[model samples]
Each structure stands twice: as structure tokens, then as C-alpha cells.
Target: MARWKVNLAVLCIGQFLVMSGMTMITPFLPLYIQEMGVTDPHHIALWSGFIFAGNFVTSFFFQPLWGRLSDRYGRKVMLLRSSFGMAVVMTLMGFAHDPTQLLLLRILNGVISGFMPAAVALISTNTPREKSGFAMGMLQSGGVAGSILGPFIGGLMAEWLGFRSIFYVTGALLFGASMVALFLVKEKFDLAEAKKKTNITIVEGFRVLMKVKQLPALYGVTFVIQFSMLAAMPLIPLFVQDLHGKGELLAFYAGLVGSVTGFSNMIASPLLGRWSDRIGSVKILAVCLIGAGLCYIPQALVTNIWQLFAARFMLGVFMGGMLPSVQTLIRSYTPNGMESRSYGFNSSALSLGNMMGPIIGGALSGWVSIRGIFIMSCIMLLGNALWVRRTLSDPQLPKQTIQKAGSASHSGDDT
Candidate 1:
């Protein structure tokens, strides 16, 4: 394999471990909170949302900081920081005596959550511009695959080894990932020049990056994509229960309902990513947005679990195209030395969406029901597609305008 491909392959595994370790507690978070002595049903619901969103809320603010540092120093160091930091926090979660302590640790997890962004920065900087879409899609696929398995493994472990033990297992997995990255990932960064150019104030950096007129729109697209997808996620188990409540089949169907989308997303990401490389990411992004929007309509109307499965599978296929396309577009629009920072902002947009989507969706479910949330997601996504059609006129920048993901130093473009 080529050097870039090798780097990509390593980072792909890191993304998988990072996502799996983080999500390994997903299926039983509420139960874990209950175990921590919050007995009321209402408290369990509230604490679950709090614990889940806290990391994202902190992540929304902190990811850009890591991005800036990665651009200044090197991407690999930041990846190590995130992986090790999260490993520590994951293990600590296993020891929490109460929801308060667990929530605080979750917030700390968000503080160090830049493994994917750092990985993306590293890959985008090194790979040929034409191949960025494929790299990103592959990385996303790896992460989604982990997410699909994490819950299943967590459930089984919760039965055999208990919930806290699973946290320890997650920690070990993350530590293993960090060791892989430390040994395997290589970069050709110029440290002295990177430090020299890294003096721009955070305010100045933000201002300079915003000068790329196309970026803000792309960030919005990223936000809507995550928000639309995740906002509906928390409601799925309830909807599955509504569809088929056959005791053991109920749990199985609910897990299947969620996992199938990710499974299809894993299948579609690389395929759509390769396609995006040829035709430009904007067209793929727009069509996928519209397709995803339409796919949700069937989901909103599905009376049977099988109908929901078909719609979700199709939705995943469309969703597979959205993020990689957006990331590619962001790379295309970003200034050379500023690529990592731009990605940071993009990740921040994603974090914000991740934090707010569930809160709003959960709130919406109270008034409109689960079906209504689906309809709402459909409308928001189609509206975003229209916005993309009107607002984004991609600079049509030439493929030859490749910039290394280093600092303002252009002398080391030898990679």
C-alpha cells in the first residue's frame, strides 16, 4: 500500500477504537445511572440526556482548540492526547459512585474528544486532494461499524461481566488504539516553521478562516446532517416498542432497527465517497440530502417494523454520502495552512448539532409524538438541501491547489 493509504488504514482503526470505546456503554447508560442510585424514572430519563449531551456540549467548544493545536504542532500528537485522555475518563466512569460524578467525567470526555477530527486533519493533509472523499468515507465507515457493535457487546458484557467491567474493557481498547497510533502513524511536519506561523491569536485565526466565504454554509450543512440524523435516534427504541412488543423480540427488533442503518451506512460510505471524488462533493451532497429527506417520510408513516427497517436502510445509504461530501467540500474551500482549523470549526458544528439535536427532538416528541419528530427531521433536511442549492456556489477550485496540512510553511510540500 501507498504511504497515505497506510496512514489512512492506521487512523481508520483508531477511529473504530475511539468510537467503540465511547459507545460501548450506550445501550445501558440509563441502567448504569440507575445503578448509581438515581431510582426515579424521571431522574433516569433526565440524567441519561444530561450524561449523553454533556460531553458534546463541552466538545462543541473544545474541538476547535484541539484543531488549532494540531495545526500548530502536528495532528498525531493531538490524536494521542484524545485517545489517552478518553481512555482515562472511560475507566473513571466505571468507578463513579453517582450520576453527578459520571456526568462530570462525561464532560471531561468531551473536553478531549478530537480523535476523529485529528485523524481527518492528518489524512486530508497527506492524501491527494482527489482521494480525500474516499479516505473520509472509509474513516466514517470504520467508526460506524464500531458504533453498531458497541451496543451489542455492551449488552452481552453487561449480562456476563457487569456494566462497570465493560467500561474497563473500553478503556483497555482505547489504550491499545493509542499504542497503535503512537507506533504506526507518521507525518512530515516542519516543527520550527509551524511554531513560527502558529502565533496568530485565536480571534485572528477565527477571523481569517471565516474569510473563506463558502465555509459557513458547509458548516451549516454538517450541522443539519448530524442534527437530522441523531435527533431521531433516541426515539427509535420507543418507536420499535410501539411497532412490535414481543418481549425478547422487542429488544432484538429495537437493536436491529438501530444497527441496520449503521450497517447500511458502512456499506454505502466508501461507495458514495468514491463517487464524490469523481463528480465533486457538492452534487453528491445535494442529492443525498434530498434523498435522505424523502427516505424519512416512509419512516414517519411506517406502521410495521419491517417498513421502518427498509426506510432506515435507505436513509443510511443517503446519509453515507452527506458527511464525506461535506468534509471534502470543506477541504476544497479551506485555505492551505488553515485546513485543520477549518475542520475544527466543522467538528464544532457537528458537536453543537450532536448536543442540541436530542434535547430538541426529545422536547418535540412530547408535543408531536415520535412520528412528528421524523416529519420535522424530513422538513429540516429538505430545507437544508434547498439552502445548499441556493447558498453554496463552490469556488470550483482546481484540484492542483493542494496544500499540506502543515502550518503557513509552504516549503515542505514535498509529501
Candidate 2:
């Protein structure tokens, strides 16, 4: 296997473990808050949204800061730090006695959620540019796979081992990931150059970030993709309950449906990414967004759990191309030496979307059937398709221009 592939595998495994563990809390959160003595549905909804969005709020602001710091300090070190920080916070989350405590810990988790971004930056810089889409897609697949597996595992652990135990397990898994990165992930840094150059500040990076014309489109896509993706999350379990009620089949099939989506993401992500490498990110994104929109319509119409699962699986397949494509496009445009900083901005956009998705989903669920969220999601994705179509330029055009320029120069008299 190639070095990039090996690196991707290692990183993916770590991501799978970490995300699976962390996300275990999702299914049980509202119930946990209720158990903690918050009885009112409104209160539960409010607190749940707070806890859910807390990490993203902090992470959105903190990501760029961490990214720039990583650029100055080193990606490996930043990954190690974030992993360790997450381990400690997750363990503390298991021990929280109230919704307030859990919410605070979640915020702390967001503040330190840059491990994946750092890993992404490291891998992106190391891999050949032509192959970056595949590498990024592989990494994303690992996380999506974890997300797919997480709800099932989390539900089982919550039932069998207790919700508190899930936190401990999550903490331990993160700790193990940190250790693996510390010992196995190697990146040699230039101390001499580091000493000679001044580190780029967050404000400076933001200034440079604003100057990049491509950044807006990237940020817009980031927000839109996340909004579309996360809009589906809060409703998955609810939709299952609505379809099948509080039965063993509901829980079992819910897990199965969610897992199927992950399986699809795992399979489709790399293929789509590799496809993007050939076809270009803009076209792939446009197709994915439009396809995802159409797929959601069937989801809204489904009466059976199996139908919902099938729709979700299709949604996963279409959505799989999104992250890797965005990352590749960002990598293509980011100036040299500011890789982490640029990715930081990208991470912040994703975090913002993460924060927005659930709140919007939860609110929408109150107004419309759980399936209505799918309708809303479909609209969002269609909007994304339109937005991307309008803003995203063809990456291939520059290469064609370069080839044309070279041909013209060669045809002329030798200079």
C-alpha cells in the first residue's frame, strides 16, 4: 500500500473510534436531561439544543485559532493536544450530575475539537494534490462510518452499561487515539525556520482569509452541506418512533437504518472523491446536492421504516462526496504555508453548520411531522446546488488555460 493510504487508514481508525464514542450521547441526551428532573418538553427541548449546540459554538470560534496555532506549533502536537483534551472532557461528561454540567463539558469538548482538522491538514499536506480527494474522502468515511455505527452502539451501551459508562468508554477511546498519534504519527518540523518566522495571528489569517475570493463559496458550501446533513439527525430517531412506535423493532431498526447509511457512506465516499478528482469538485458537488435533495423527497413520503432506511442510504451515498470535495477545493485554493489556518476557517464554517442544523431541525419538528424535516432538508440541499452552481468555477479551466498558453508560447519564436 502507498504511504498516503496507510496514513489514511490509521487516521480513519482513530476517527471512527473517537466519533463513535462521542456521539453515543446523542440518542440519550434528551432522555438524560429528563431523567435529571427537567420534565417540561419545552425545557427539555431548550436544554437539549443548548447541549447539542454548545460544542459547535465554541468549536466554530476556536477552530481557526487552533489551526493557526497548529501551523506554528505542528500538526502532530495539535492533534495530540486535542485528543488528550477531548479524553479528559468526555470522561468528565460521564460524571456530570445535571444538564448544566453536561452542557458545560460539551462546550469544552468543542473548544478542543480540532484533532480531526489537524489530522486533515497533516494528511492533505503530505498527500499528492491529485490524490487529495480520495484521501480526504477516506477520512470523512471513517467519521461518517463512526456516526452510522455510533447511535446503535450508544443505544446498546446506554441500555446495558448505562449512559455514564458511555462517557468513560468515550474518554478511554480518545485517550487511546491520542497515544497512537503520539507514538505512530510522525511529522518532522523545521525548528530553524520556526524560530526565524513570526507566527500568523488569527486576525491576520482572517484578513488573508477574506482576501481569498474562493473562501466565500467554500464557507457557503460548508454551511449549506452541514445544514442539509445535520437537519436529518434529530429526526432519525423521532421518525423511527413515529413509524414504528416504542417497540424493540423501532430501536433495532433505527440502529439498522442509521448503520446502513454509514455503510453506504463508507462505500460511496472514496469512490465519489476519486470521481471528483477526475470530474472536478464543482460538478460533483452540484450533482450531490441535487441528488440529495431528490432523495429526501422519498424519505418524506416513506411509510415504512425500511423505506426510510433505503432513502437514508441513498442520501448517504449522495452526501458522501460533499466533504471531501469541499476539502479538496479548499486545499486547491489555500496559499502555501497557511494550510492549517485555511482549514481552520473551513472547520469553523462546519461547526457553525453543526450548531445550526439541530436547532433548526428541532424547531421544525415541532411545527411539522418528522418527515417535514426531510422536506426542509431537501430544500436546503437544492439551494446548495443552486448556490454552488452559481459560485463554483471549473477547476479544470485553469489547467486548460495553462496548456493553451504553453502551446501558444511554443508555437512562437524561441525567446
Candidate 3:
């Protein structure tokens, strides 16, 4: 098999295993906190917030650092470290006797869960330029699949073996994936290039970020894009229950809904990527944002589960293109030699969005109706579309450049 394919396989397996562990915790976490002998509603709410937000809070700080480290050290080493660290943190969460302990562990887990960006950097660095869009789309789809699967499996396992077992299982899977990474994954890092690094400080990453003109627009678009996309996530299970009516398999149904979105991502991601190659990433992303905006409106109107599913599916299709386009755009924006660190900044944008999205979604859901959240999501997406149209350049490669780049691919080595 080609090196790119091998890398994809490795990433996909690891993503699935890790995601399965994560999903197992998502739905049951509140219950787990409650079971920890917490009786007060306010305390439970605060504890829940700490549990969920803890990892993201630390991750937001650590993600860029990890990205830079991956660039300086090796993405492979970072990947292994993240996987192993997640295993330890997750396992510890299983053993926590109180909500406080769990909260601390979650925070620790956040600092360690920097693996995703590292994996992305690894694959993006290795991918042939001609196939970057497709490759990125594929890798992201793997993550989506894991998100889809996590909640369902987590719910089932939590019920069957108890909440604590879910953590144990999740830890084992991640630990096993770490072992796979250490033994099976091989990478060639540039010692001369990495070693020749000048006196670049960690603070300098912020300066580098400020100096990149297009990066601000990219960051803005990313924030709005994820805000729009994840604005519905916090309400999904509730929506499912409302539309379908509660059942013995409520969590499973919720998982099914989540998985359906991943299913759509799997179907649409590659098509969007290949299409982006032909027409340009910017145009496709523009259309996707517009379509996604429109799709959210239908969700506000849907009364039944099937309609909700259709709306989510359409939203997924549009979203599938968004990240790949952003990744391709980041590559286009950064100097070729700085691809690793440039990607680190891009990853930071994504991590920030991920951290903020659920918080905003939850607050919106609390303040307004779930239907109102969809309207807000539409506005956010449309706003991003307009912003991108005005500020960002089209991502189309020049014809001569495409021909030269494509010809070079035939000789091997994208760089």
C-alpha cells in the first residue's frame, strides 16, 4: 500500500478507538457526577461544567504548544504521548471517588489530548499536495465516525457494566492504540531542518500568528463555522427524545442520530474534497456555509425525528467540506517550509472552536428554545459565509501551477 494510505489506516483505527472511549463518557458523565454523592442541583451543575470544560480549558492552552512541539520534535512522538496520556487520565477517572477527583482528571486529560492535531500534522505533512483535500477529508471522517460511535457505545457500556467500567474500557482502548502507534508507525523527521531552528521562543508563535494576515480571517471563519456547526450538539439528545418520544433505547437512538451525521460526513467528505480540487476550496466552502446556513432553518421547523435526521444529514454534508477547505486554505496561506507550525495555528483555531461551541450551545439552549438555537446557528454560519467572501481569497491553484505540481507527483515526493 502507498504510504499515504498506510497513514490513513493508522489514523482511522486510532481515531475510532479513542472516540469510542470518549463517547462512552459524554452522556453518562452527569449521572456519574450525581452518583458521586452529590445531591445539590447547583453543585451537580457546577461539577458537570468542571468535568466537561476542564479538558478543553487546558487543551486550549496546550494545543498550540503541542503543535509547535510536533513541528520541532516529531509529530509521531507527540501522537504516542497523547494517546498514552489519554489512557492514563481516562483510567484514573474510572477510579475517582468524588466529582472533584474526576474534574481534576478531566483537566489533566485535556492537557494530554493534543494528539488529534498532531495526527493531522503528520498526515498533512506526508500527503502529496495533489491529494491533500481527499486525505484530510478522510482523516476527519474517521474522527466524525468516532464521535458518532462514542455516545452510543458509552451509553450501552455504562448501563451494562456501570459508569466506571466505561472509563476502564476507554482507557484500555486508547492505551492499546498508543501501543499500536509506538510499534507500527514509522516516520522520517528532518533533523537538520528541525535542529537549524533559530532562537524562536514559544511567545514568538503568537508573533508569527499576528504577522500572518490571512490567518485572522481564517480564525474568524473557523470560530463562526464551528459555532454554527456545534450549536446544535448539546441539544441533540434532548431533541431526539422530544421528536421520537422516550424509549428503552433512548441513548442508542441519540447515538444513532450522532452516528448518522458521521455517516453523512463519510459519504460527502471525499466528494467535496475532490470537487474542491477542481473548482477551488474557497468556492466550495462558500457554498457549503451557505447551504449549511439554510439547512439549520429546517431543523427549527422539524417536528419529527426523520425530519431532524434529514436536516442533520444535510448539515453534515455541508460541514464535511468545511474543514478540508480550511486545511487546504491554511496550507495555501503559510510559507511552504513553515507548514507544520502553520498547521499548529490552524489546529488551535479548531480547538478553540471546539471548546467554545458546546458552551455557547448549552447557554443558548438554556436561554431560548432549542428551535431558537437553530436560528442562531443559521445566523452564525451565514455570517461566516459573508465574512469569507469579503476577506478571503479564492483557493484555486493557477493552471500552470497545477500542471507542474501534478507532473511532479508522478516522480514521487510532494515536497
Candidate 4:
């Protein structure tokens, strides 16, 4: 295998382990908080949100820092650092005796959380430009697969071994993933080049990226996609109940409805990614955005559980194409030698979206109807598709516009 291919394979497994480890707590987070002695329902909900948000809150600020370090040192080292740091934090969570301890550990986990992004930076920088879409798509599948399986595995473990054991298992998996990255991932980083760029502040880096015409728009797309997708998440179970009229197996049905999209997404990501390589990432992105946006309309209007499920599954298929295409576009536009920092900033945008999406969804579901949230999501996506269509049509926009912008900025700096 080629070195890039080998790196891809190793990173895939590492990404899977890291993602699964992160998500394993999702299935039973409230229960874990209760075990830590938070008995009030209101407090449980509050603590749950706080603990969950804690990671992303810290990660949003820290990702760029890690990305910059990755640029200076190497993506592999950043990956190892994140994996090992996460492993330690997760293991400590298993020993937490109180909500405060758990919350602090969760915050620490956020501070250390960059494994997947670092892996992305590594793969994006290392892969041949021609194969970037396929590599990123295959890489995405690993994370999706991990996310799909993590809840199931965590639920089973919680039943058999208890919640604390789930933390231990997750920690062990992360440690093993770090070991794989340490032994297998290879990089041809130009240390001299990295050294030269090290003095550039993160603010300066963003200024450089912001001058690129397409990058800000692409970041907006990331936020919109995540925001639209998640805006319906907090209401899905309630929607399922509304459709199915509630039963003892309501939770099961809701879980199934949720998993269908992930299943379809996992199946479609690599296929569409390869397709994007053959066609163009921007074209695939536009098509998928429109497709997914339309799919949400059916979901909003669905009269039955099966209809809703089908719509969500179809949405997942289009969504599978979305992120990889975005990543491909980011790669195409970013100047060489800055891939990691650029991706890091993109990751921060993604994390911000993740943090905001559910909140927006929750607020919308509260203020309006659940179905209305779906409609809102659909509108956002369709509008975003239009934005993408207009902004990203010319592939040369970045190269031409950014060069002029950079020269002008340099002149200003000189003056």
C-alpha cells in the first residue's frame, strides 16, 4: 500500500475508537449523573446539558491551538497527545464520586479532544489531491460507524457491567487507538517550513484564511449543515411518539428512527465521496444540500412512522455526501503548509455548530411545534444550498481572489 493509504487505514481505526469512546457515554449520561447522586429531575437535566456542553465549550477554543501546534510539530504528535489525554480523562471519570467531579472531568475531556480533527488534518495533508475526496469520505465512514455502534455497545455494557465500566472500556479503547497512531501513522512533515510558520499567531492565521473568498462561505456551510441537522434532534423522540402514539417500546422506536439516518449515511459516505472525486466536490455538495433539504420536507409532512423513517434515511444519504465534499473544498482552497490550522479552524466551527444546534432545536421546539422545527431546518438547508450554488461555482475563485487579497493585506502590513 502507498504511505497515504496506510496512514488512511490506521487513522480510520483510530478515528473509530476515538469517536466510539467519546459517544459511549451518550446512551446513559443522565443515568450516570443520577448515580453520582443528582436525584432531582430538573437538576439532572441541567447537569446533563452542562456536562455534555462542557466538552464542546472547551474544545471550541482549544482546537485552533492544537491545529497550530500540529502545523508546527506534526499532526501525528497532536493525534497522540489528544488520544492519550482523552484516555486519562475518561479513566478518571470512572472514578468520579460526584457530579462536580464528573463535570470537571468532562471539561477536561473537552480540552483534550482533538483526536478526530488531528486525524483529519493528517489525512488531508498526506493524501494526494486527486484522492482527497475518497480518502476523506472513507475516513468519515469510520467515525460514522463508530457513532452508530457506540450507543448500542454502551447500552449493552451499561446493562452488563454498569456505567462506570463503560468509562473504563472507553478509556482502554482510546489508549489502544493512541498506540496505533504512535506506531503506524507516518508523516513527511517539513520541519523547516513548520518552524518558519510557527511564529505566526493564530489571529494572523485566521486573517490569512478569512481573506480567501470561499473559506468563510464554506465555514458557514459547516455551521448551517450542523445546525439544520441537529435542530431536529432534541425533538425526534417526541416526534416518534406523536407518530406511533406512544407505547412501552417508544424509546426503542425512537432510537431506531434516529439510527436509520446514520446507517444510510455510513453506507453512502464513501460511495458519494468517490463520486465527488470523479465529478467535483462543489457539485456533489450542491446536489446533496438540495437533496437533504428536500428530504427534510417529507420528514416534516410525514403522516406515519415509516414515512418519517424513510425520509430521515434518505436525508442521511445526502448528508453523507455533505461533509466530505465540504472537507474536499476546504482542502482545495487552503494554501499548502497550512492544512492542519485551516482544518482546525473548521473543526472549531463544527464544534460551535454542534453546541448551538440542539439549543436552537430545543428552543424552536419549545416556541413552535416539533414539525415546525423540521420545516425550519429544511428552509435553512435549502437557503444554504442556494448560497453554496452561487458562491462555490467557480473553483478558481479561491486561488485568484485569495492571491490578490493576500498581496493587498501584505501591502497594508508593510505600510
Please tell me which predicted candidate would have the highest TM-score against the true structure: 4
Candidate whose lDDT is highest: 4
Clashes of each: 0, 0, 2, 0
What do the candidate models score in CA lDDT, each in turn?
A: 0.84, 0.78, 0.76, 0.85
Could you give candidate 1's per-residue lDDT for residues 370-402 as a string of tens digits? Answer: 888888889989998988887666456523222
Model 2, residue 40: what's the lDDT? 98
CA RMSD for every model? 4.3, 7.6, 6.5, 3.0
Minimum summed lDDT over a 10-residue window in model 3 is located at 397-406
lDDT of 3: 0.76
Error (Å) of candidate 2 at residue 407 is 37
lDDT tens digits, residues 230-270, model 4? 87887899889999996688888899998999999989999
> Candidate 4 — which residues are off by over 4 angstroms?
397-415
TM-score of 2: 0.84
Residue pairs in collision within model 4: none
Rank candidates by lDDT, best first. Answer: 4, 1, 2, 3
Predicted candidate 3, C-alpha RMSD: 6.5
Give stretches of model 1 more than 4 Å off: 245-248, 398-415
